[model samples]
Target chain A: MEVKLASSYGFCFGVKRAIDIAQKYENSATMGPLIHNKNEIDRLQNDYKVGLYRDLNEVKPNDTVIIRTHGIPKQDLKDLRAKDAKVINATCPFVTTPQQIVKKMSQEGYSILIFGDSEHPEVKGVKSYGEDLEDVHVILEKSELDNLNFKHDKIATVAQTTRKKEIYLDIVNSLILKNKEVRVFNTICDATFENQDAARDLSKEVDVMIIIGGKNSSNTKQLHTISLENCSDSYLIENETELDSSWFDNKKLCGITAGASTPDWIIQQVVDKIKKY
Target chain B: MEVKLASSYGFCFGVKRAIDIAQKYENSATMGPLIHNKNEIDRLQNDYKVGLYRDLNEVKPNDTVIIRTHGIPKQDLKDLRAKDAKVINATCPFVTTPQQIVKKMSQEGYSILIFGDSEHPEVKGVKSYGEDLEDVHVILEKSELDNLNFKHDKIATVAQTTRKKEIYLDIVNSLILKNKEVRVFNTICDATFENQDAARDLSKEVDVMIIIGGKNSSNTKQLHTISLENCSDSYLIENETELDSSWFDNKKLCGITAGASTPDWIIQQVVDKIKKY
Candidate 1:
């Protein structure tokens, strides 16, 4: 059995930056999680007095606020600032690009639609960028575009940085069919593309595929999702310990791919463990 | 501003499909030009079609022959009864999905990355159904991925139905970085998301965004490329005559967009008319 790895895999710019920033701020938090990782977030809780608040309403004026890579709404920032909260903005640049576009188009009175998960923080941030549109449609399916009755002739379409390109275009194409105007800026991150392409390729040549990353990571999730499409003998795991050897019983060739949030050490560990098998 | 309409815009799904299958059989002219768009493949005409013996040299009894989206690959239906030539297919499931994946994956290597340009007919055709790579990358980056490196794994990436998505992931963030394994599916339907989005939005906004389709009339070229983008003003016109007197003045808000293969209607028409302003 041979082992294969992707050409473009592992921690991306944003994830690398987030991890670094979170580590830097770890000293200040007392009881709150500083990062999204269960292990890392847990470490932060034990180290600092920082507490995660579901909403800012619970936050006092003097408390510190650390924004995640998903990013918070711009308006929320304004309100947070109004209340005199110290903020550590860790918004990924790719995520910020869509917000900028939505903000500009919205200022010009363009109705907005965000192509991504409705609850994603990045999408929420993008929606907040809209000054005029009260709520932006979060399109999920190709059929959803068919159902949309876009009111404005002026509509600006922005994708949450992590959304798939195929789904994004479907909505844009549907809008074109309806004769509604749509300016779409495909803002999905370069990292997500890299991860996906790498995983898809790695999975194909291997008897079994293993996609590693934070389960909550959108890009990681996408990598895992893409891997499943390419190889049935695949598994999505957060770290090496999640390995289930029974699935590999008949498989000799193995391929390994990891998402952006996954640490290099974890991926190496998986590679070593797979080699042992 | 001199509005330069893209040479390949109104590529209907059918045309895109045809082109996809043709490109895959690049070594041989398995069939005629997949799509009828001259401008789309101007390079191919003068660059490659050179051959000595046209017929039998193209394929042998066991050798594979491809049929485009308009057709199928290698040894399809016609030769299936007789072992004349092996079939290689590039049929769009938008032309044949329900039969293949659900059936094939039910027994064999279900994991596959059928590559082709996302918007092209051929790629869209093959990808028309189930268990393909999740979140297909529409492959439109002008640059590369985080770093120009291949992964250490295997990937089952495929191409678009029309054109190929290069396996090259450009190092956009930094050209110099760690090397990784990569499997790339080059799926680029020459007529892609950019034009669709641009045309749709341009048509619905501004004094008027012109539609440049053939007098021969292909609905694909006449596509909406028409969507709303801004509040100032928006309108759509097929040709210069469709332009109303009210649309122009010494000073007016004019935004122009065109479809694929729309020659100006010929670059000349667009230049001459816009020059009048």
Candidate 2:
């Protein structure tokens, strides 16, 4: 069997930057998981003594706290700062753009429409940046636009950094038709687009596809979704331990793609284990 | 046989306003057919003594030159003003809006995308309103977007007054995905939307659909297209003379929908002819 990897797989620039920063500040506690990948978080804790704390209450006043790549809400950052904690901002610069836009556009009285999953931390954090939280709406699908009743004819929209560009534009177009004026910012990062495109391209040429990343990772899920659409025998696994040899029974070619948060070490381990077949 | 008319059919507000303005000025000549319906133009010439001239050269210095409902190119307007002719601005308010947006947005360095037929006068007039003619692109289909090489990241789009909303929105969505920023003005008139919707509603309950308006009428052709999709036995007719008795043979119900430019008198004549069958 032949094993092929996507040309643009493994950790993206933002995630790599976050890891590099966290590694330098050993024994520091991250506000949340530094990135979405579980194996990477485990490795960080075991090797570098980095700690993961979900809430601000868990951090000591003088302890160094590292912000996750997804960033924290404005209130949380204020709370951290008020406690006199040493803060290292590792928020992806792409995510920072939409936060600034939401704050500026909302201040200008344009109702903000954020195209993203509402429960995701990136979306939650971006929502906090708006001047008026009441005016900001997190929409996951196009159908949500119909449910919206807005008093403001002027609206502005921005998408999460990892969102599919097509879905973001679809909602923007619908909003543009209903409102008199709309300003849209395409905030999807180039790395996310490249990873998805690479996965899609690899899937088309392979008989069986294996996607390696955390199940909860949005970018990972998107890659798995794109792979499944192109190749029927596609599986998403977090680690090599979950890989089944049965998947390679009749497959001549196996394609692999990892999400943005997935580290190079985990991907190499998965490839070595697959070669054992 | 039962005859039914669309609730929102016949002369729309803009067309009616143009005709009302023209009737008030006797012996005046329209730059072109004031509206798409030829029958109405003939009626104006015979009863109202308003002639239709295709060129500005035909108008005397003191002659009242009535601009068509679709409006004229910017250069033509300037020439008419330069000649000191008495000009009646009958350009539809709905059509005038996109003209203003194209001019303003283009001046602000936005590449204009017009969802319209390339040969249509209204689209041509709107295109001429842009600050740079080279920056304006008339896209009739989505595939044309691939051929575009845009220098500016900012794109502003508007649709012709008679276009389908879905088609306009589809192109806008595509443009939004490709461009960094997009400003869209949905210029499809309310009357056109209402007429198409009413036609779709009527087609569902009828055995045969008869669409009435001028052959060259864009909105008329759109109505016929909508009718054909819902009811296979749909036909387009300009007047009572085109009605065939065989179309009504064994037909229990027939629905009639007139375009925005179709006058009430012509619709009545078609209904009368259908009733005789």
Top candidate (lDDT): 2
* Model 1 lDDT per residue over A1-277, tens place: 4678888888677767766676676533211233446655554556653456666686677666777776777877888788777777767777778788888877777777877777766677777777765535677777776556655765667666455565665565555334323454546566767767778887777779888887777777777778888788778898889998896898888888887656677788888988887
Candidate maximizing DockQ: 2
Question: Candidate 2, which CAPRI tier?
Answer: acceptable
DockQ values per model: 0.02, 0.41
Worst 10 residues of 2 chain B by lDDT: B161-170
True contacts kept of 2: 0.62
* lDDT (Cα, tens digit) per residue for candidate 1, span B1-277: 3353433355455555545555555554444344445555554445544112234444556544555444332223444426476555545444454235322432332333343345654444344443433422324343433222322222223334322222322211111122111222222334555666656555444554445555464443444423344423344454666555554554344555555454333435654676566
What stretches of model 1 exceed 4 Å from their correct place? A1-4, A10-12, A29-36, A46-51, A142-151, A161-164, A177-181, A190-193, A206-208, A213-238, A242-254, A259-261, A272-277, B1-277
Instruction: Give residue A28's lDDT in candidate 1 (0 to 100).
Output: 38
Report clashes for each candidate as comma-separated counts.
97, 0
Cα-based RMSD of candidate 1:
22.0
Residue pairs in candidate 2 whose N, alpha carbon or C atoms collide under 3 angstroms: none
